[model samples]
Target: MRLKVLTCLVAVAALYAPQASAGSKIRVETRTYDVTGASGIELIQNINRKGPKRGFMAHAIALTAYSASWDLVMLRRNGSCRVRQANGTMDLVFTFPRVVSPMSPALKRRWSRFMAGTHAHEATHGRLARDMMRAAERSAVGLETTDDPSCSKARREAGRRIEAVSAQYEAKQKAFDVTEHRGGGHVEHLVLALIKP
Candidate 1:
């Protein structure tokens, strides 16, 4: 799962030029915390206890954190100010569990498979975060004020749009989690398989 990081980080940041390609894609940073166990049950226990605690209360099997930074440019002429460009970058950090104990080859294989699926799920969140940033940039670029020469109005408008975009994307992320977390769904299946005796 991904952190519901504040998308409207600052409402708006002032800048000028065409949209830049700074944070369009994710350069994921993956970190693993060692989980100790020799069997599936023990390994599962360690994971449950040692996994990142970024969720509501219980620990998350894996977690992805996201943040967006924007580079905005404004063009003003004839007492009209408009966004000339907006380049928003998304940064993703992922936390996962690693097995550090000796286990049977069969168990090792199972652990690998489980981790693979878990990583894929977290990656989906990362992609969603990137999409959200792109949407935010689009909203910023579409902002303009025909009379606000000082660009105050334009800045305010951009801020509002950024908030809206962030809210919209947060909803999307929650919906995705709902689908994956439903009974007998993808997430449940992966978890059950990993903890199976």
Candidate 2:
């Protein structure tokens, strides 16, 4: 009976081994950036309101945009960005302060500016991450063959694309700095911003 069980195990392993070998190994890392302040909640809320088309929101707009385009998973709040490596994952956390009242229209305008800038900044990181994963995936496949000029060329092209996209995103995000109060204030307005990727 023991021999039969062992044989069955071996058979199962053999049957699944090829498929497992063909599948690429995936690892994920996340990084969080905190944008804390008295207007942090309002900032996040405004950013979320921009949606995907605006190209300035963090959740679905930035995360989904990159993930869908680059074949990477934009994990929500501690979600993982899967890579074809075993080096675990990176987590990025962004913290911000609470909102207070006495917010004037002028303050709201400033908040809007802040949100737009923050979204642009975070989107750059997202783009970089996506590019990195794509490069890794290509490397995994490229290492297997020798004298495959086509594959090598493709990999090189992919690298260039990644670099270009990363630079563009980074430049856009870094262009604006947060110019507002950091903390301290009473809760005049409470906007519940959903915690998502």
Candidate 3:
């Protein structure tokens, strides 16, 4: 997945303290497809039926697709200090396949356990995104410009800081995924558990 960057600049007549904000916002969205199967093995096959035979593609077996973006709002008025408010949004999308509702008790129990593991795995991605956003926001909120008439330099530096923080977080995400997807890792364990019957 690719990261989309959208920055919005706004100047308002207000002043904010030169300190990090306490709160940040996070949003999550989930989208699912349909898969039909009667048994655990069948379910796995159905989930991966349409998966690509290529590299680094998230398929419906159990996938988490996420992206984080930020909106930088700067406030400046005549004879007033320039203030910045950074709002970061992390969107996490979990794509799965729908299974049959009515199934045997034993099958249902296994399915439930598998789903729990998948959900937990995806939740980690969301959590990481949220943490990165908060760090970016904190960095942006602390920026200050001494020259009131020319705040361009300050703005540019703040933008760079935010970008750098995001880049670092992205690296962390890649590393985490590598470990989780390695042989006998969490993802593999989840799959094995699902088809253990």
Q: Candidate 1, residues 2-42: lDDT per residue as tens digits?
A: 68664533333344444454435555688999998877778
Per-candidate TM-score against the hidden true structure: 0.88, 0.33, 0.77
TM for candidate 3 is 0.77
* Better-scoring candidate (TM-score), 1 or 2: 1
lDDT of each: 0.76, 0.32, 0.66
The best candidate by TM-score is 1
Q: In candidate 2, how many Å is residue 161 off? A: 17
Error of 3 at 36 (Å): 1.5
Supply candidate 1's per-residue lDDT for 18.
48
Q: What is the lDDT of residue 170 in candidate 2?
A: 41
Expressed as tens digits, the lDDT of each residue in 125-173 for candidate 3 is 6677777788878887747766565556556767787888877887877
Poorest 10 consecutive residues by lDDT, candidate 2: 1-10
In Å, residue 49's CA in model 2 sits off its true spot by: 27
The alpha-carbon deviation from the true structure for residue 184 of candidate 1, after best TM-score superposition, in angstroms, is 1.3
In Å, residue 188's CA in model 3 sits off its true spot by 0.9
Find the 10 residues in a row with the least total lDDT in model 3: 1-10
